[model samples]
Target: MASSSSPPEEQYGTESTDNYETTCWGCGLRVMLPSGASIFKCGWCGAITNQNKKKREQKCFGWRVLRDRCFLSSVIIFMLFVIFGGVWAVYPIVFSISLLWGIFHSIITTILSIATVSFFSLAAFRCAGTPPNILWGSYPTVGQGDLENYTFCLYCSKPKSPRAHHCRSCGKCILDMDHHCPFIGNCVGAANHYSFVCFLISAVLSTIYVSIMSVYASLHIWPSLSYSLGRLKGMTGRDLAWRLMNEILIAFLRSTLFLSSRGLLLAYLFIASVSLQIGLSVLLWQQLSFIYQGKTYLSNLSSHADNEEEKKDCQNLVRFFGFQHPVSRFFSNFRVTQKRHDT
Candidate 1:
């Protein structure tokens, strides 16, 4: 018999008669490791497990933030510079190249920045509009034996839950108001506000980052041509003509040079700008909606938080919104119930 402390056969690469083949940790299936590898990664079951793990992690954390679209745009801009392939090395051609590059980068960066910004905005709105837990302020199904002690909310004039809040901005009860944000440009209430703000914060940061990078790229690539009104002073006719020619060349280079289809790039940029603006616009719209409805992030999360003149009405509305909201049902398991809203 082998000693109890002997290393496993696999550790010593010993020959074993027993069946020993690489297997997936997720599924009890045998699979060969890739060549020159000691471990095998399960393609199917592993993927499922990993995804489940990720989702579980998301539950623990607020949410998984996506990579910045601005960063992607930055990569694209860099790629464009690469495409030019030192054609810009020629000073004579620098004029046209620089000009064209600026126009092109500006248009593309603007578009991408907008898109990146929008993604965040959309996320914020979705979070704010449809929060996680939905608790109908409707009386909980209390039975005779139910010894659950409940508290009343001053704001909504309803039973308070563990996680409810009062939104001062909206003058109503909120479930889980993180904070009011002017950047995503909205007040994040109980619903999807986390995701919404996560998206916005990520987006705002990305846009600001990309914008700064684009500016740097501009300065590095074509510093002077982006701004030039007229001919250079104290220059002969020949010199003026040369300078004009140089400017024209830089302009063209800055505008047209790219890694792929020029037309496509332009179109994408236009779309990006429009999309970002639309997202911000949506968030802004939500601000007024909540305001008129008279609610803030904290108040919106739970209806029971606020105890004002219209506390009952507010509770009813919260119950309706919490119950009918698409995300409310989904988040029920997470204990994101409307009971959190304190009156």
Candidate 2:
């Protein structure tokens, strides 16, 4: 990393005279230095200037303290829906299709469910993980004025690193910040971006798989219903309406009380699966768009040209999956990147 401290006497030369002035390490404001002054605070930005230490200790609220409990609760509820309505309810119906189909479906569903759970857990860990270090000065220095593309963080009392931004929610400066995601209850930055993307992908795939099974199960239910209603003879409009309503009510009661109706269970799963699938799809599209543009979510909000170095799609994949060989790059499309520090 480039040093952000005051220039050495060899570098500054005669410029290091008693009248020499430097820019504040926090906010770039020109401040005059008193002779023999070692430690001083920035009057403008309120950043304490100390030449010996590049980083200062600041109180940080880690994942547990900063997490949004409500969002976590919602995630748990959704997981339950997938497990009970989607997975458990569809198992028997899949087996009834054929022994071969049952075996195949079981393997696929189990794999997808495990993947979804793993990704979600990883994402949660990343979200609560420690963020990148704040950019602090090595030595006390006067402010010269703010540098281009850099700003001071009043909360961390440190110079914001290139591509870093202060997250009000995190109460700290984050490097390569994308956005604060309410779903994860944390900011998506260079560190955890890959985990977050994986979570979204797995959730979508799992929901879609469940949805297909639900549809198949639903098809099986209509035949049973038709057989039961076949006994009804030609009737008046009012009588037909009453009969259909009563049959639906009975089916619902039977399913709820005995858990015997594949149709009712499949119906519930289908609706929930479709709803979750749509939402996850939208989020996945947005994240992919950001990756394609070589920009973070925050950068996308502005029209300004991105100053950070851009990574190729394959390089991003390698970074995310920690691939060492060239062959692994071919699989980049299925993966996303994260900073090494995040791991």
Candidate 3:
């Protein structure tokens, strides 16, 4: 058992009868002392530890997690992609270029995403358990001294977990806690970290694909609408085509009512709108799918409280990936504190 404060009687030193023996958590040095030994003086390495008990206790943030105003604006851009992209896809008929455009954009975006996620994932993993103050170098935190500890979480309390921080947002210690992105709308923790990367890969591609498709669909619609108007004015098919394609202007006086006998460009409109709509629909649904699964910015690492759920999530994730590494079980957990350090 770890020593706690000695009883009131042992304020300074009691009688010689009150001695207890315990192993040092700091350096494994066996220490024999009074019942009230609150601190351990390690003879081997000269490290001071909370000898009273068995062991003692101990933001890569601010760069990426932007202001609410900037963040909310980014969310708006994504929303517009959904709304307009859907309308455009489901409408008119477009050329084969739409296919190439979507595919090309998706692939390029996916590559970029892969690069980004890879960098952060590897960096955070390497840096886990390192305090942010040391990680970021000297900076003003809300300007608290014991607040030095505020830079890094006490990891359930590990020496340091780089990129790891106590997410007041998450209200738990997180491993490799990157900014909780509300856009994808999830905290980027170690457990769901890969998934967040995957989401970024898929999402950027999906959005770009929808964008090109939306543009193509819109192109087909308005031009066809113009073509129909020309045809309604009793222009010949060839003439109407030229006018709609902006090649020629066919002016014809129908009845004074100005009702043009333009046929509906139903084919182009229907096809383009449908295609754009389908792509957008998929993108939006998948984003929600990611969030619903609780797979977003960070991989959802199980916390101390998530004993059952975290265990399940960890097992499921590891199994799904088919990795059999044992280090996952032992190294992933955080200790409440590290042994106190001395100069």
Candidate 4:
């Protein structure tokens, strides 16, 4: 039997009332109140709740700010890599090798790479700048019987729609939130999911093009590196070791000294391009998988399975991107639009 007159601690003696059961607002999981008795942090979704106020805090200022800055810096670094590694380094080396074909291919790849980067950068910026739609109060047309369809956000003190969630980083609730991406400095939601997807696809394509060009450049460098190693076969143990070390030193210098060896510049560009390609490819694959399954990264983390209504909602999202077919979605992702939805 539950005690009514006394506090929970008093009734239970040594047992603490701070361990009270509560529901996590973020992921709808059961969680225990913290030892302090004033806050409950959800381990699943990283949501922090005020036990006394029964609300989540709006802003997270400390590490989140630093993290956001780091992400922005990463974007800058990526741009630099594309400019220096792809344009200046690899393209020049290719041009020096075969003038006509190299110039033609380099120009085409560089233009395409630049266009993709520009489009995605614009999309990411636009998505980050856009604000989320928040429902403030009850609808006049919604009868009392339909109240269960809506949920209230304790933090925002507003009515939350079916797919909406509170973003601690953004300090508000986001409608149909996919995930909060620090890399883009925004929450991926219904308003920006299209842009986010477009950015991913563009990034993937750009990286792929760079990777192919990088491989071609790398093939030219392999002969030089192989020749250096092949010269040590007839040398004795001590002489072989000394020669090997000297060859490695020369190779390192050749790769690092930009003005001296084209091989080094090509090698550097190849590694960077291939690495970016692999990373972007994996990310694109994940995004595509989520789209095909009609789920966002956040929804997946919360174990939200799609029903008929959610499937319908997903169809609406696809249509919003001006895409009716999967094949067309890739090509038309960068088409800018002013369409906005309040729901």
Candidate 5:
């Protein structure tokens, strides 16, 4: 007998109501509900079932993969060009300055190049934290709450953890996914997030160094500015600023006509490095801010949707860097000893 007042969708058990029987993916048990019911959780195994969700055919999967590969290859080629081109073009001027100075810059360049490339490789090639496999699909094997807050991943044909997000481009579910970076041809997630951050830091430093060295080299070889500033000697403030900029621009254009191939390359490298520096610095700042707020880029968006308050704390940064437990344990021991003595 069915209760008259109970909602048809809320009813459970194997007996069908208007042929609305469905099987639980977790427990592999038949359950009955109304035809309108599209979402439900198994009472026995607590596995969420969403009848509305289905595997989506990715039509542009190949195109996305190709795009990522192209971007990654371009980035690698650009990096190699910068390294070899800068060495060839700038080293002559540097060595001319002094042997000690040249040697010092060589060491710095080697260290920066090694560090930047290493971190970039690690971040790009590493697996971005796959979710651990769990027992499911049978009531006997799957205990209650074993797959708590888990949902069926139609794409993976498996249970997806609450913390995980499916990256369509990566063709997999990534645990604690931040975002997919086409430049690296990888998803930024739990496993590679730190490496990605380190790469950004290293890349920024390398760019700064490259910009400085490019400027040094260019200044040493640049032709003297033929500025006709005798008419504007008495100009002050904004007028002086505008006139000075105009004269510098004219001088630069005139000097470019006489620049050697190496000088031109140094100028190009300086502009490219400065542009990259600004972009990478902004990205690094954004990543650190998200880390300090104890949220990933996706989670931050979800939190905003849910109207949840962000827990902004320095401890989040410390914990993220994996130093919380040891530091807390060291302080806890002294606190425990002091409390024992007081007692």
Candidate 6:
């Protein structure tokens, strides 16, 4: 453990020409600092020490876990409802339309359902990346620059790497943490980040497919709507548009009164899927854009705080997906190597 010169006054001490000594957490050696300097970097091991950082009590930790569990349960239930309810309501109409079409749609639904659920489970249930264990606190074991930019995690009582962030909800430090998602009941860190992105993609696609199918099913079962043609005859420009929209709205409202149980369910599914699709599409776009900039959500926020410019490059995206270079470049290099070998 690092030792401060003055346990209480070191943090609140006044500035002076004098100097004080504090122990570095990395090398466990005393380091001298100017008076009133609350933050300093160790010259020996390059570890950063911030006197202002203090551990806070994790109040209501159980309550946070409970809240996350509740949210997770709600998400699971909603997914189940969408899957079973949509199938029950939409399948009959789809089958009635054409045998081959029904089978094709069933296959699509199976694929989307499997993909969405698998990705979701991987993202939610898997560990969200723990920081690697390293030897510290001893001068003999720790070497120069071994703990560069490292800070002591008061809660974990351990050295936290620069890339790690403490997640109160997770009760631990997560390496490359993006954010803690209540819906997933987990942190979006290095281990689960790929899964989380995949889940978002699959979810968005599933919602789009569900919305389209729901609309298609509704079209087959929708009750006839009565609209007056006289309303459009005397209208033009904005007036025409407003009048047309109003008439359609009125007709749809009136037709809904005659909708069967299946039609009503189809309408609900369509609305839900479209809403989820829009929200999830935006989230996916934001995630991809951050990846393209070689940043995670948390890192992006930190960069904004530090007024750092983002490095936007396609190579970041390629590296994130585990590619060293573009496929064309990779193949070109391979071909050149093959030619050299032949010669």
Query: Residue 269's C-alpha lDDT in candidate 4?
Result: 62
Over 88-160, each residue of candidate 4 has an lDDT whose tens digit, in order, gives 6576667778889787986777676666666556645654333334322222333222333345567666556
Off by over 4 Å in 1: 1-111, 123-141, 144-150, 182-185, 208-214, 217-343
Cα shift from native, residue 80, model 4 (Å): 2.9
The TM-scores, one per candidate, come to 0.29, 0.63, 0.31, 0.61, 0.85, 0.86
Q: What's the CA RMSD for each of the models?
A: 24.0, 10.5, 19.4, 12.2, 5.2, 5.4
lDDT of 1 by residue, 200-242 (tens): 4444444443434433434434424353636577777888888
Task: Give candidate 2 misplaced runs (Cα > 4 Å).
Answer: 1-23, 26-67, 127-150, 223-262, 306-343
What residue runs in model 3 are displaced by over 4 Å at the alpha carbon? 1-163, 224-343
The better-scoring model by TM-score among 3 and 5 is 5
- After superposition, the stretches of candidate 5 with alpha carbons farther than 4 Å from their true spots are 1-20, 32-35, 233-241, 303-310, 324-343
Clashing pairs in 5: none
Give the per-residue lDDT of model 6 (tens digit) for 90-147: 9998899899999999999999999999999999999999999988886778766788
Q: Residue 12 in model 5: shift from native, Å? A: 9.0
- The superposed Cα distance between candidate 4 and the true structure at residue 111, in angstroms, equals 3.8
Q: Write the per-residue lDDT of candidate 3 for residues 227-326, one digit (tens) a residue.
A: 2353437677787666665533332212212432111222333344456456646754554444445443344443543333323244444543457765
Mark the 10 consecutive residues where model 4 has the least summed lDDT: 1-10
- List ranges where model 4 is wrong by over 4 Å: 1-53, 97-103, 127-148, 218-262, 303-321, 325-343
TM-score, candidate 4, is: 0.61
Model 6 alpha-carbon miss at residue 250, Å: 2.0
TM accuracy, model 1: 0.29
Candidate 5 matches the true fold with a TM-score of 0.85
Cα lDDT computed for each candidate against the true fold: 0.42, 0.65, 0.43, 0.62, 0.87, 0.87
Candidate with maximal TM-score? 6
- What's the CA RMSD of model 3 in angstroms? 19.4
